[model samples]
Target: MPSQTHPIDPVRYGTEPAAPARPIAAAPSAVLSAVDAHAEAAIALLSDLVAINSINPLFPGIDRAAVIGGETRCTDLLGERLAALGAEIHRVAPDPERTNVVAVLKGAGGGRSLILNGHLDTVAPFTPERWISGDPWKPTLKDGRLYGLGSTDMKGGLVSVVLALQAIRAAGVRLKGDVQVHAVVGEETMSHELGTSAVLEAGFTADAAIVVEPSSQPFPLSVAPVSAGNFNLEITVRGRATHAGNRGAAIRPGGEGASAGVNAVEKAILVVQALQTLEEEWGQTKSHPAFPTGFFSLVPGVFHGDAGVPSVGYMADKATVGYLVWYPPGDTADAVKAEIERHVGHAAALDPWLRENPPMFDWKSNWPVADTAEDHPLVRTLVDARAAVLGPIPRGRRETWSLNAVTDASFLEAKGIPTTVFGPGNLRFAHAVDEHIEIQDLVNGAKVLALAILGWCGVAD
Candidate 1:
């Protein structure tokens, strides 16, 4: 669709004198009041969104229909709200089940454009018995907090974006540039592919972006402009099954025993050890100023093997291991891939069996490391806005930080749109049962975001 245009009065968009700058402190009150006026509306929207089971069905045992319904319902609801607020809306669904809601608040067109993006999908509530809150879909508000599966992870943040936009509009502030909000799907499962990444691929652009991803736990008000890149790797080891009692007869060149077969599981153990050592070296030497934990993490999260039928007491012939690798900004996904290949290749050469039947590699779900300079206007705007709303800055808490987990923000960064991750929820609580977000944090986040948008996009009188 073509860019929408609106006629603007000459005083604001043309020769008239520009409005005097308002004190930073004065900015928050109006926006905050507007947000407060709609406080109940925000909470109700969040509660309704949380009640939808938009869990990514890609996880084991999750119902696919639930995920479809969740994404469809949430996106539809957000689209309607945006329309009611008078923003131009676009609904895109690369996958029929997962729709992305893109709402554009067209500005007077003289300032930088801003994009506020958030995901709608949450991870399936696994092992709910561990949840003290009981039902994951039944959202509960208690002691100034809202508890549910997606509340903290992102539904809360999503709500904040909607309300922030509404508050800005309610205050009768017209922006010089456009403000776009993307309510995406499939973040818990694909991070990008079926969500944010797909939206950008379809030709979305902005001067800067703020992903309303949660920032809970140790650093509640922290902003992450830099995030690590990550990908999933699968390693397959081949072996031949053999009987345990055959012994020497099986070892002989012409022997009919299972000794001739190699145990792939045994080979897998060596690979794990080698990779762990590499991970240790990375932890000790590489570090990002913003991301305290350094980079290049290789975690083997899954492993499985198929041994020859136990009835024959034969050795296993095949093994499989799944790994997740997170690399810092300086490390490219290609570099990490090569490093793993080199390590595994060298280890394979050491064993004759592995040399002939080398372990196979399957790399998937790759995303690049995302980093924006500390001084970037968008980062500075948000950092300042956060400080203004939350009070004096703490010594250890800096304006900018990094996230260990990869997010859809990286996709935008790859597109050259400076993006930062900020919002209300804790990453630790995300994907866990009984996930929750503080009501105060949600309100404060909305105020901060509104301030950032007003400053970066430039409000027109």
Candidate 2:
């Protein structure tokens, strides 16, 4: 059922700021009531967003022809819906046909501005047949959860933001500060250059931001004010190749042992072992208040023997190892790199071959850290909204913690805009075969976000 809204008064709702809101003495009952009425509409919008095949084309092994331009269509759809609700829409395409939409809904005036951020891009569904519904794009509602691709990782969060704006409009509520919704592309690749960072670089800014990333710090969602940083590290080791028949000479005490062939894979293994030892050291030393003890870790993701053309009769000359390293927000990428390099360097020194030919490193695609204070106004406001919407919740749900995964929130926080991650859904389902979010959770998220908006932006009296 739609709530009746009186025509907005121009004097109260205008392009310019009016005056700062006085101390909020009463709750905005109308906005909360409107969000409840349109609760189902939030689920419907999530279904629509999930149905779009907006898989990022930049992903490895993705068929560009099948998913290249889907993001543009999403932007178009979001633009139309927001425009109809009196928002000014801006679409950013850092790459061709890959668009990020920023919709700005003006406020009455003199309130803190806010940005609600979400990514429109999703990873391709590699195992679509594995989905219970048999189709990744066909939204299904069963047992109170909406199942579909991007439904959790974050079409649900995006839908919550849309519902918040819709309810505010439907209730004829004009905020004192403007609210901006940034639906971005390329997040699946962490290509912030073409997504979240690009939006800010293009001059779309606010006093604060909320990245509605899936926040299942164990169910019902937690407010995450910090997210660990990560980097893709590739290490290459070199060795001298020789005929397989020289194996005996390579290791024998007197059979040209120093001059014989060296195996790169074995040397790479030493490096990996040394790094594992260093990882244990990190586990003991690197710690943050917002994260679990020993949360920072170095994980080896891929390994390859440098054999461009295989000839089994020969000793391998080179090898490469790929690693994903997660570091605490309190540290810098350069510092972590130096630490690993120092450890590896010391380990390589004792080996005769490695001493002369050291391992090479290539750091790629680093996601920056996000560390907003828990007591910041934006976070405090979100806590207030959460408490009011969900009475007597678990301490973890309202307290700030470090998200185990990184998000575009890093970009916003890096740019000095205080930001936090809070929304509905479990991360285990984000990029999994059967992604979903509960309908009740979705409704509750929308309600909470609506009030948070009013709390932060204030109401013009």
Best by TM-score: 2
lDDT of 2 by residue, 9-59 (tens): 333223332233324435577777888788777777778888999988988
The residue pairs found clashing in candidate 1 are: 216-426, 242-314, 242-315
lDDT (Cα) of model 2:
0.83
Off by over 4 Å in 2: 1-27, 243-245, 252-255, 310-314, 393-398
- Candidate 1, RMSD to the unseen true structure: 8.8
lDDT per residue as tens, model 1, 198-261: 8888777899999988865245747888888888899989888766555356456677534366
User: Residue 67 CA error for candidate 1 (Å)?
Assistant: 3.8
Alpha-carbon TM-score of each model against the true structure: 0.88, 0.91
